[model samples]
Target: MPLHPACECHTATRSYEFSESHAIRGSTIGMVLSKQAIPDISQNGGKHADFPGAKAPYVSKMKFLNEQSYDPIPIYRVIDNKGQVIDRTEEPRIDNETLLNMYKTMVQLNQMDEILIESQQQGRISMYLTNYGEEGIQVGSGAALLPRDMIFAQYRELGVLLYRGMTVTEIVNQCYGNHEDRDKGRQIPMHFGNKEKNIVTASSPLATQMPQAVGAAYAFKRAPNNERCVICYFGDGAASEGDAHAAFNFAATLQCPVILFCRNNGYAVWTPTNQQYRGDGIAARGLALGLHTIRVDGTDALAVYRAVERAREIAIQNKPVLIESMSYRVGLHSTADFSNNAFRSVEEIQKWAQEENPVEKLRLYLEGKGLWNSDIEKQFAKEARDIVLRTIQEADQKKKAHWKEMLKDVYYVMPQHLQKQMNQMEKHLEKYKEHYPLDQFQSE
Candidate 1:
């Protein structure tokens, strides 16, 4: 609120009040201007050297600010690691049905991740990224938003999609690249998108969705009485991308209604936060860029829900907000990342997995409220696992999209070049019909 409280720059001018007592104390006249003086001077057209870029009062001190000047931004948390609400007033007033749904969604996401990761190892899918310890950040924030609000996600936010009503079958179909997939078997596994759900398709390049989300938010801002806002999710690694800087600056300056959600899960692949950056974290960057910012404990679903609920309200008023959800990545970055050679030790992973697991934390909270028990947990776990397994089996049996389908979607009216290419492919496939597994693919 006071800018950088420890930094003796612009914040120093706004924080102090001008008084006769200060003059009596021989305080520098440059540092004596009160917060009320700025507006009064401006209204009277006083000869203050007002810079077009900055409106801060001139300060007497010549001091340079560094990372150590301010303390790290405190993370907001409604519940502790034991899943007990630290403050009753801070706890969100979620309905029992919604709470159960959120808990179940997170469990389902975890179950899906387990089977899918194993499936990847068994060569059932090409690749997979697990949600692991960040399920609360996904499901909690997802539940706080309106379904109509747009979402632009990085690879690891499957729980958000699940919470937004994406069926397990739809997800498995995409993973298997079956004919029923919304992308028509075009995209790689885990790069999910659904137009009906308002979630943009994930791309492999880091932070590519940031600017796109801001553009969409700008469009929503222009719409009269627009209630919708865009939520763009990325990992801490993605936050280091150049596109992230552009997106933040544009969102702040243009007053776009967007939430830049950063899952600061302790590592950018193998690199830890210490190696990633020197400053406080992604939230500090948002503050410097003029965006409303907050840091939340990613493992606490209730805290995440409360933070995002308030963020959405601010965003709808054309104020962009940045939320840094802090947690640890308890799993390997992806199936490609071998655990034995992982940068983090097994013990560290296990510690976070057991102590700060988002799903387990929510389960404890439910148990405390008399809303859950071992019986319910066992039943839901089995049901979730069965659903994922059944969906995977069905998806495996389904045929791949027709080979010709790929070239068809590129253009509404096929051009001569593409048409010739398609014809050539067809002729080649026909000649080698016996060599190719035609039974595994849909017929033309």
Candidate 2:
């Protein structure tokens, strides 16, 4: 029987395809296009000085007489588990050495995370967040970016900063909370910031960095600088924040070159994905928001690198891309969490450690290619330990900063009110001089 032209039925022209089992690995849409069909400049609620002119390039010609309603969009990706390259077109043009470097960084990050957490437990630092499981997401994305292009990150992105040439000594100094710390001892340990690297200091507040990243990317797109894009890193938990949504709308509307990288590690602190949203993956959320999205196995370095490589290309072309890297948080959310917390079972952590270890995955890949062996692991561990221990030892010996540093860097010059406050505080301290000798306590 002939089916009606508009019928939802297949006839002689139907296509047949066989599918094999495939494992699926897995931020923002602007509000203007959804609400007004035409952009409402006033709908841009906050300070977007850099966004000038048409905000939505994809729908600049649309006309509407009513308030527009935009759909919640989900994101997209290219890589999968088992280290397979499923998207040939988006495959990165990288060498084996580059691949090896990515794996090495992942291993280094794992060791660093473990070492830092131990350091915190031993009273060496005030706080720490482990980048243990999300190593590939940061390392691969960081490697794909230009050195000069600014990167804004959340608290758990030491791998990215390290890949961008941050020294272990500097990391140790910051961890030690000494005056020599590049952040001037202003933040908690593992809180990253480097003006010279053009990497903005990470604030403890969640999601704030996302919008700033949008602004930075917008500047790069509008400025005379030769740089192409900016990459911002956040966690799946951050995806629920208002700032993340706001940043996406701003970036999409302005056609800013930015990549929103979300590490969907299955939990946000004590809350699991089942508790956060009904969606199966964050990529679908990004797609609903009208973003070009990608989902990949976050535990696979090659997959992450390839996805990020293509993301960078799209960002450079003045379009935004959002990547959701699906992985696990093998460690506690931070050093502060009780190891025995019921948020996750010990058995779950053990299961992931045995199977989803990204370092082990890459090591297996390397060994399969005959490029890795016991000697490589031994040498890498020895060097990493030696270097890390030396840096920490030196940092521990450095002088600490005075409380006055709390007021420093907050202004170009001390305002009159601050000057007066500083003087008053000094006077209050002078009264205690006879009770406690300053010379005896001065850090050297």
Candidate 3:
């Protein structure tokens, strides 16, 4: 009867778990069905019965918030652009004087960049790199470092060096490639290396310092010093390199005490950030790799300082921390790209120069606080200019290095063929001594 009861299944059956968690709160039954079953969830399938009039207008709809909700990562800040603290949880911890100092370091770094770049243009120096929009990142983080801690800087970190009390003369000497340079004039301009300051010498290769930084941090951990850690600085463009990923993995594996600061300035040379990756920000990538990470407004010195302070604490606890300072590179990547008419528009540059420039914001903060008046500002500018000019003049007055520099430093003794080459160079210098008169140069 009824086509044999054992063989018959008359009804269509659909099976799924019907827990309260499976029910979406704000969606209608039909809408939920349309979304769950359909490849393309749309009202075109006669689903927009709620308002038939909505069909004619063709308002494209986004999916209802079931699983995908936009949760913004918390942004940490200590001081506003006006140099006032808005957060009361750590009210007495951060004071105005500390902020002023941070502001001053930012100014000094910006000023130094301006001077060095201009010096390069004037043919007074061979080369220089500027941290045009990134002074706050380096100086603020550097302020959190202990005196004995190691700093592995990218070439454009004179601000951090200055904060550590690197004298103007030392900077000039390094730039000038003189005997007074701690590297013995081995490296080029902005390739800073000072044992006294505990800053590693910068190299020309991108992301080359990443591993070295990790090694330094590992050493610190093994040695187990309370005051020892390694703070490494690099750009967002550098993060795309393999060395960066390797360094992160190595540091995470070892729990090395390293603070990796990435100034995500939207460009690596000429490439923009949109082309870099589809994922979230660089700080998120750091977090994904099991590092304590933070992203902060790089233009805000106080926020950067506080984040760095926290990062320092984490680092001391044998955690590798990554900090991505969101900033804009307002100037050309270097002095070599002088054309304002190329790649980027002048209007874009001017907009940032007026509003987003770190130096401009710091000046505004200083003025707002009544900490710096017009007269003092003018005096500061004049003094900075004079100091830069004198430093350049002194560096230029230093004697040029001899060809023996090429043969030295890397070996305890020269090989026979190398010695022959050195002899040839010495002969060439002797023959040209009249033209480059040794007596005309200052004593090393």
Candidate 4:
């Protein structure tokens, strides 16, 4: 139950000294840990980091210095809540299209989520997950990566697929599990992937993508002159999975080009983030593994992009980076999860809706810069809604997967045993013509 033995934060007063000559370039910007004997805290509990601008400015540093070796990772912020640029240096150098696209993507994500959620409720679609208040983390991080860099996603990464030009038709069809669905109705709603875009198939299992990303990145290194890294996404809850920790350690040890992006929205399902872990959030785990790590404001798209852009650079060189984006969800975890009905309050969700909507936060910045207007906003919303409706209409016409698909991809050549079983099924269906619908399995 203790932290990793190599977790320097487990000690007091981390004994680290900088060696400029041996340093990894472009890193070591702040608090580079060097190997040395740490001094005893011999003070108050000594289980926390002592940063310069810690929450307690009044308390003396020595009084709180504990056995904890790592400091709280500083949050990198560029924009404020009112959409003002607080740090000019950290601003991402993006063109107008890039800037406008960020706003457009967020709006589209919201619109699509709304329509799909309605469909799920109406029984038209099986399930859906809303980006809600965390659209910035979804769209921003997606824009930061190149087409070749792979994304191993958690379920909530619809923004990433939408940004990469996944159409409403494709998304709707997948959710509808119709004939046009890419996976041939194999996966449930929201678990989509594009082979051409280099995105991995999203599975429902928690924390599985992190380790997969590392292995994929390792394989990428062996490819012919391939210059790419893997970006894996998971939630605060998935970070608790043992696979996540194992992936972190392997990533650091193997020196793979992978960025483990953790969306620390402060909850893993119904459990509040406070109950998730005792140490610093997901970012600290990356530091404990000695990987270059960063914490950023998830509500600020530019900040998330900046962190990921730099992380991509480091990852391309076969160095892993972990990013923790602090944000909150306005809606429940998913269509099946009714956290508000049981554990959360309506007022709490409403509070985030008004104060922390990432889409609105980015919209405010764009409007303030004279890049957006109410007219444009209305157009964005209206067009997104129309497209989703049209997609749904077309998807409804498509039929389900054919019978051949049942046994098709399981093997290059249908094994004799499976072939025999299929033949027997066909005969049985023929015998029960009234009950069995052979045409449904035959073809669309």
List model 3 lDDT by residue over 1-444, tens digit each. 111111122222223334444546865343223223322213333333223223232337865642135444456665565555577574325467765676667766667788888888988777777787777677777777778889898877888888888888898888877666666667888888778889888998889999889998998899876667889999888898899999999999899999998888878877788888655668877876889988888877667778888888889889999998888777778777756448678887777666666666666666776777778777777777778778878877777565467577667877788889888867987788777666634443
Candidate 2, residues 31-115, lDDT tens digits: the string is 3222223222232222221125434423345676321244433223344434444577865677788767776777677677777
Which regions of candidate 2 deviate over 4 angstroms?
Answer: 1-91, 433-444
Give the best candidate by lDDT: 1
Please write out the lDDT profile of model 1 over residues 1-444, one tens digit for every residue.
222222322322333565544455656454466565442212112223344575665556798999999999999999888889999988898999999999999989989999998899999889998888899999999999999999999999999999999999999999989899998889989999999899999999999999999999999998948699999999999999999999999999999999999999999988999999888989999999999999999999999999999999999999999999999988888888866345777888888989898888899999999999999899989999999999998988999999888898788899999999999998998899899998999886
Q: List the candidate 1 regions with Cα displacement exceeding 4 Å.
A: 1-49
The local lDDT score (0 to 100) that residue 432 gets in candidate 4 is 85
Which candidate ranks first by TM-score, i.e. highest? 1
* Per-residue C-alpha lDDT of model 4 across residues 208-236, encoded as one tens digit per residue: 98899999988987773688889999999
Kindly indicate the candidate among 3 and 4 with the higher lDDT.
4
Give per-model TM-scores: 0.89, 0.79, 0.79, 0.83
Q: What's the C-alpha lDDT at position 350 in model 1?
A: 89
Model 4 worst lDDT window (10 residues): 1-10
Q: Scored by CA lDDT, what does every candidate get?
A: 0.89, 0.74, 0.74, 0.83
Output the better candidate (1/3) by TM-score: 1
Candidate 4: list runs displaced more than 4 Å: 1-71, 436-444
